[model samples]
Target: LFKPVGLGYASMVIVFFCNTYYIMVLAWGFYYLIKSFSSTLPWSDCDNEWNTPSCIEIFRHQDCKNASFANVTVGDRNMTLLNISSGLDEPGHMNWELMLCLMAVWVLVYFCVWKGVKSTGKIVYFTATFPYVVLIILLVRGVTLPGAYDGIMYYIKPDWSKLEEVWIDAGTQIFFSYAIGLGALTALGSYNRFNNDCYKDAFVLALINSGTSFFAGFVVFSILGFMAAEQGVDISQVAESGPGLAFIAYPKAVSLMPVAPLWAALFFFMLLLLGLDSQFVGVEGFVTGILDLFPSRYYHRYKREIAVAICCLLCFIIDLSMVTQGGMYVFQLFDYYSASGMTLLWQAFWECIVVAWVYGADRFMDDVARMIGYRPFPWMKWCWSFITPCVCLGIFLFHLVNYKPLTYNNVYVYPWWGEVIGWCLALSSMLCIPVSLLYKLFRGAAPVHHAPTPDLQTPRRGPADPRAPPPTTEAAHFVRG
Candidate 1:
């Protein structure tokens, strides 16, 4: 079996690669948030230098006289600003606005997590709650707009035939939402006290996350309905997906609203908070994995602060390529390969195998019982041992078999060399497993042999016992999985 150190190292690799580009998204959010304060949003019309003659303004308000609201001429300017370069081959110079935003984002992330949970924990009080406030406000405003009912209905209406094509996408969304195989969840979990009722916490977190997602759908679709109505197009035509939806369609939708800048500012502020919340957590997870490798190394004053600074600086330098004129292509490549569903499922499958089959699921249940003071239902044991790993492996293989080249708005497929680079990004993280295994094997590490099944017969150990593990926040003995 791979040691905890090896697993932790692998987790760090995943987080580092994922976070590097992931935070670039936050930089975009910062740019939009700053831009939203203007009387005329940059994307609200075709007047900007970045816009082409073909650019069409979709804002339907009487105040917007650039073109008839519904007359979309011959052009769609959804991502024109972000995708100024023709393609990945023509990576133009750095976008100083976005570059500065990226630097600011990295700086903010560093300060938030430099002190670890002490500072981040406090910040979550605002970051975690503020999005919901904005979403609520948006939902209320959205439902009042003309054609809002159409949008909400379109959002809630089931499309059965699409399931065959999109079920895998849905699964991937679930993984991303919960941060399933990411070390951030595990790193955050490590801080819990031994008897802190994590089982309950897990259920609550799942509910909240899923519920928020469902609720946000209303906020989004309602606005999309308004956009479609303004453009005299079906909701599907105006319901742009991905960054186009967030950066273009949604901004234009808000610009037509009363107090346009106010609503736009709130929307982008919520986006910034959401991205920062995720960003700092991912950074913290990587930092924790590194610090744990040599706990003694952090004994010096401000060592953690220095470590976080270095991490942000290195990642910022590496990510500078993504803030260039062709940065969107690079960003999409990283998002597709580095944090793809395939990589996530691969990690999750192995994690389940190690915990359930290798270490024994019944024994794990016993450990949980020891921590939470009762045995969970037996079905959860079956899930850990059989159900989850099989599902992960099945989906992993399915994705591999059906893999497609990355594209931009389904128009520009990445070149063969670009695809090769994407696969390399993917393999960089997945290779950690075999690399760790080979290292252990070369060192002549013995395969672990499990003892008899745990029947809750052993008494808990105390801090005074030399054999006991370190104490938890609640003073209970540490229980290693």
Candidate 2:
């Protein structure tokens, strides 16, 4: 919608809202860590008597505390994990303390990136690397636990029956994990010097990213295995994804380990650092996009620090909704719909088409050669032209055919209207490309020629190159053409 002026601000606004939930969840982790210091272990405080007769009959456990079974109804209709109520509900209530922590995170993010890349660059040196240190420490500790091997095995073991779902999940994860549909990669690349070897960097970073993800799986599942052992339940019973894994399951596990407070603090702090790095990059992408579109004069007059602050403030305000009692529902909705794989697939397909077809693959290669002193291999061109688009299109079609309604914890299926709203969110980014193409086609009265200019003739060795070129009609025609 803001294409006439620039798409930078629009990109920033979209990213801001999308990442706000990440910030909120990170804050929730912090809240749990801090709360752990004062209260009894989150798992150990369950009531002696079962609140529901069904729960008593099913599990036959004296108390709900320290149990792997999460569906046991405790008080009212609420289910308990480690005696903590699973606050997974529609229009769920707000958490004031967590809201305050989220605001603090916003403030911290603003201060960290307010000065722009210089500040963020330095911050990333620590934020980016510190998580690995913590992860290693946790991994070392996690593997030492009795049931850790079981957890690791479960994480790596493939269920052949679920191969189709696995492929879909893997594809979606690869796309997001590499940060591909989001313009963050593009925005980050824009900062590189013209001569930077982007092709080389791409492979290195991709490998490192994939490796980190693989490493994290062991750390996470190993810990969950220990938790399952402690609770005397199956690893599958204790396993959860997303917020449940970070806030409820992991924290409960940490509470069981020796030096619980220290480990809990370190774990949450690692989460904070990891989340901060992502937020920093996200904000940088937004800011860089705007600055790239606008002239330097305008940027100088407005000031980047102020621009960043405004972005942060707007994000903070908008995210307040997600911090409300019912905010998890809102957050889940955003996660389910916004920046979804379908939207990403659509974006990637069109981007490949544009660069490989509309923009001309040969021209793109020439441009790359000019910048990096060597062109990418021929296979890359083929990949861009055919393989990429076909894969993206195939995945998108497959997803549409196997479309599943959004659900929370296998309950609370989104209403059809809600699903429609989700589709709108997903399509918002995908629609921009076709809309812009149509707008350009209809708005223009004349076709624009985009043929490359021919290389200029070298000047005569001695001097007076103009005189030499003026002699021949062919030369003149070539020069003019």
Candidate 3:
């Protein structure tokens, strides 16, 4: 129960709540999966075929021109949802009860983190691997569908003109998907065995992650295409929706299938597992970073639980805005400012600075080489040093040029002060880097130990290796534990 310092324990406060929300959504994904197997499931009553060129049909169809027709039938409720009138109904307010429910969700997340990373680390083992399993299942099913190829073409068939538009999205997706630059990479990098092959591990992780996203498109689009074929509608109509793609779009597809409910349930459940690992690991980074930067801040005390409790309370309150349909608004704002384009740009820039500029490139490369038994290629060094910074800087400016404030109810906008408030909020955890450096400058560097920072960096240690290869003396230069 160690207490954090400062008048406001800002970063901790943000992580506690934000991470909680993220995991809750992930849990919903899991819940959906479980519901799929049951006869009594969401949107299960309808037996109507989903759409014309079914998702599977579209995925499998390479010609993109023709498809075998599936008999068309549409369910009652599904039709009602798509009706024009359904779109106009406005509660125009937030749901207090759900907000309170969110509080409970946050509390559950906090309890898991009570024991810190040691406890949290165990949970990631299951959460991280399950999504891949689900993806494989979906991929197998999708590829067999007649129209899946058409759906996949829609995903990777980039309009080069739209590349600039999608560049931010693609970059943002990479950033959020991998949780890069949000201090997670930096802190995690610190934990690596000094000479662990980080580059290889990174490549492998990328391979797996990107492969999942790409393959997932096949499954998702195949189903969509299947629905399209069943409904006699075009694929464009299906792709136009938002999260509705999950809630409305996919459920409709299931209803048309032989065992619709079961598939829906499994798909959602898989989402939960993926999200659970993502949120917990994110929170862990925040927790580890705080402890690393300010050892005395939360020294033994009852403050840890207190911090957790406070986060739960605030999350529900802020999230209560969801009742008004503003919940999505609030989420979108936080998602954009806290974890979106701005955040990634900040991360990419800062990380490069920390390792390349502040710490020095040769030293950083030396550590990377030791961990994996090879140094970064010349191109990598150039990217880490010169190219990355410029790219990030340019992109970050684009974020500013396109800056739009988040509104409370699509009317009253968050003030400029609110943007300041948001940035200060996100930057709180990183205060340690500069503060620690200042302390060293004034008091003289402390003796090296297991830590990977300046006082400790004779060479090696930090940024936990997910799973890497054999190492020698270079491992000591980066990390061993």
- The top-ranked prediction according to TM-score is 1
- TM-score against native, each model: 0.90, 0.83, 0.70
- Clashes in model 1: which pairs? none
Candidate 1 lDDT over residue span 1-481, tens digit each: 2343255556677789878999877888788888877888777777777776667655454444334334342125332456357789988888898999998889888888887775677777788888999999999999999989999999999899897558888887788788887888777767656556778777887898899889999999998898766666677766766776777678777777778888888888898998888887799888877777776844878777877888899999989989888888898899899888988898888888888877678877887887778888889988898899899998888888988889976678899999999999888878888787677668876543333224323455312433344334321211111
Q: What is the C-alpha lDDT of each candidate?
A: 0.76, 0.66, 0.55
TM-score of 2: 0.83
340-430, model 3: which lDDT tens digit per residue? 5665566567667655665667776776676567677878877888998888888888867876666432334565665675666456544
Q: What order do you get sorting by lDDT, best first? A: 1, 2, 3
Superposing all C-alpha atoms, what RMSD in Å does each candidate have to the true structure? 4.4, 9.3, 8.5
What value does the lDDT take at residue 194 in candidate 1? 53
Top candidate, metric lDDT: 1
Cα displacement (angstroms), candidate 1, residue 291, comes to 0.6
